[model samples]
Target: MGWVNTHTRELFDGYYSLDITYELLLGGYYPTGINANSNYVARDLAALGLILSPQPPTDPLKVVWKTIWSAKVPGKVALNAWRIAANILPTRRNLSLKGYDGDTGCVLCSHDPEDSLHLFINCPYASDIWSKAGLQWSVNGAASMHECLLATLPRLNKEEVNKTLMLRWGIWKNRNSQVWEQKSKHASETFLITLGWYEDVKRSNASPVVRCRQGVKLVKPRAGQFKMNCDGAYIPSTRRGGVGCVSRNSEGEFLAGASRPHALLTSPFHAELLALKEGLRLAMTLQYTEITFESDCALLVQAFQQEDQDLSTMCLLIYKHASGES
Candidate 1:
């Protein structure tokens, strides 16, 4: 007579609820019959000894996080770079460690294990792309992904870091296309595409008005009218802000200018409103009667033009100043 597998039988028989038995048999738990909660997958992975417990970062990892996230790269590119540095990217090697059974060879070169470092830094294809892009540093001798990033970041300026991150992203994208669509790109082609992307990003970050109005002369105010131009600047890293305002005559000759730093952290909108308020106060003090206030912040200007029930702190301050209550 054949014997039933005792361990499997015990697992099924020991469960008191149908739900628990179903969860064990199907390899997932559905708290709600039709809709599974989002955390169930994470919980299931944790129970299978697949997911590692979270730990506090060491000093080096903290530095790497700060450097990657604070780079002037785009948000998605920066996030991917951070994931690569953290070794959390779903490379074939990482997926295999997480219980997936698949080929773990580098998809680009297929000669080495597809770890984050190998795919991004140590791969011959990646090295070729770097060389074609004219980057000075090579990741051939770097010990690990974090070490490579730490060493590479210090040598690159903001623009170079942005380009480097974009190149890494481009390589990953090309690898995916090759795997999924059976399409492959040459290193020179990838480099050219990444360069085009970087140029587009640079252009998008430039002032639209300035780009459109190249070589156009600025219009001056009418005679006997003084124009008060206000602007604000804020730095996210330091959480500091400053405001400046300048009064110029119709001839574009500066009459007065004032600049002051904020005592506390604030948003750019608040800083711009404060600058406009200060400019109004300065004009009144300087006895300029026919003064036109101007600022690049179109939203703040529109807020002043139309009366609404905006209860924001910045709106309240703007309302007060615009109504001559301050």
Candidate 2:
């Protein structure tokens, strides 16, 4: 209490090679006054792996130093090191990063990316895949492509999030492969491949199928009233799915409603499970306390209680999510 902290650009030791004071003051991690004045050099001294082939490398540091110094490509290590330091970079992109000089419209839809949502979700090709997957997507007046992806994250769970991420990765990879490799496949095919990958992972685990317990804070219902309505639809064409739901007050007054389509395809049982997920998501969104989820698929409802669904595919995804074992 006798002396107060002061802001200065003094360094602690000579380990780290950057100005810690500037980062602490300007970075979002620290927003205080006195704490921002402190300066410290952060360094990792973890041991590195060694190679035993040919001549055993006595020191791992020497090997790493030699690799960095001997690289033919100039600035390669520096650029790659920067990327490693910033781990939050995206692994995929929804649109051609190459800005349109003449072609302002999306190649897939001929729509403007000014809103950014059109580049990824609102395009006709994207919409078709979504429809095949049984989702009805809408943009919330997004101004950038990143915003659209951010908006989608809050609506997805671990399973749904993984599927969404893989779909994006596959789509981006397909686009690049088509341009460079001169091989093109329809969006529908890519989506099917994504679904197959998800199924393969689940089946490899050999887990039983059941509805994973999802806790959602729902709105409380008034006396003698229902609070939510759930609906399920299955598309035989793509074996894709759509789930729609609405929340209502005790008087049956509408509060909010939503519909989502999935890009993966599977049996009717999986579609039914998707419907349940959609209903639960909607219920959570409206904070409904007493949710009355309804579905036309009876087999799916039974699968929710059964230990094993015996679905030809989608069993692992179902079990992984339902059991929360993963």
**lDDT winner among the candidates?**
1
Instruction: Provide the clashing-pair count of each candidate structure.
Output: 0, 10
Residues 1-326, model 1: lDDT tens digits: 01222333444455345455445535543223432322222225444342134555568667667767877667888888878888898888889898988788889889657987888777888889888777856555877787777777777877787778889998888888988999989987787766666665665677776435345456789999999999988877776898899999999999999988875545677788878878977998999889899898877887777765443445555655677763
Error of 1 at 321 (Å): 56
- For residues 1-326, could you state the per-residue lDDT of candidate 2 as single tens digits? 11111222233234332355345433543324533333532222121011112455475234333433343222432333223223222222322354434434444444553223553466666666667665555557865544554455555545554454455445545644754686756887777766666555556666677887766555556675565566666778876777677767767688788888865656666666765676677776666667666556666566565774343245555665576532
Q: Which ten residues in a row have the lowest lDDT in candidate 1?
A: 34-43
Residue 243, candidate 2: alpha-carbon lDDT: 68
TM-score of each: 0.46, 0.33
User: Which residues of candidate 1, in runs, are more than 4 Å off?
Assistant: 1-58, 138-140, 210-326
Q: What local lDDT score does residue 4 receive in model 1, on the 0 to 100 scale?
A: 20
Residue 5 of model 2, lDDT score: 18
